[model samples]
Target: MARSGNVWSRAGVALFQLAEYLHEPGASVGYTLANWNISFGGSVAMGAHRSSLREPSMVAAGVLAVDIIDGNGNIRHIQRDESSDEWLADSCPSGITTCTV
Candidate 1:
């Protein structure tokens, strides 16, 4: 029983460490700003999530979309509409440049 408890404890600790590492600021798998105008400062994954809320479609003119990776190690388009300005404004700060759409 004591041995089992030790094994469980070690496993829990290992899992916790793994989670912490995954959540760490620099541990992301990819990164990108929906709009190129926004500057990013972190691992690729962190940058992607942070920039995903900006006026990607308006700035990029439909080129800026969600970040996704495909089996070929390439980023796939996630698609964003020009009409989502409200949601983008809500997610991004006011100082950010608004989409003219």
Candidate 2:
């Protein structure tokens, strides 16, 4: 996981831990799962949602970019706005990774 400015990034981490780290006055994750023990990668794979009904379950909605390792062991960084639909759908939601956060 990495923290750059207000854009928090994660590959594998506990949801509660992430929440704790982001917890502070005026600092929040915006959307989170009710089950704190769930891992970030797992949640993304499961398409987990926040407790609020207004929020959607597509966790990728909050993600700005993702670092993925291809089958050939290549680290490919994909940005939300600049990436293709196929790349985003295949990499972000699957939680398939051969690289560390």
Candidate 3:
């Protein structure tokens, strides 16, 4: 995680905690950003049995959508591979939707 010097720094910490909680065995998470009015949901799947003496692993999947915000905030929607600068400045229009990995 990146660190920022501001009062909203707590937001980053909270987000990290939320991620950790979702990674717990049999755990899941769903959240909405009230300020941005966008919703997100995802779950973690445990890969190894608990009784085995091997390190456990997890996989996660989720999607995020733009609510009323314009393509500016839509950077959140870009796939993990897409470049934010290219998409925000060149690809999508004002109010359309785009999905990222």
Q: Top TM-score: which candidate number?
A: 2
- Candidate 3 lDDT over 1-101, as tens digits, reads 23322111121234345545555543433342222221111121111112222322221222222223244554233332344663433233322233333
Instruction: List ranges where model 3 is wrong by over 4 Å.
Output: 1-13, 26-68, 71-76, 82-84, 87-101
Candidate 1, backbone clash total = 3
* Model 2 misplacement above 4 A: 1-5, 51-56, 95-101
lDDT for each residue of candidate 2 in 1-101, tens digit (9 for 90 to 100): 43435545566688777777777434555567546787766776666766556755566566666676666777877666635764456544544442333
Best by lDDT: 2
Q: Model 3 — TM-score against the truth?
A: 0.20
Per-model C-alpha RMSD: 17.4, 5.4, 15.1
Q: What is the TM-score of each candidate against the true structure?
A: 0.17, 0.66, 0.20
Estimate candidate 1's alpha-carbon lDDT, on a 0 to 1 scale. 0.33
For all candidates in order, the CA lDDT equals 0.33, 0.61, 0.29
TM-score of 1: 0.17
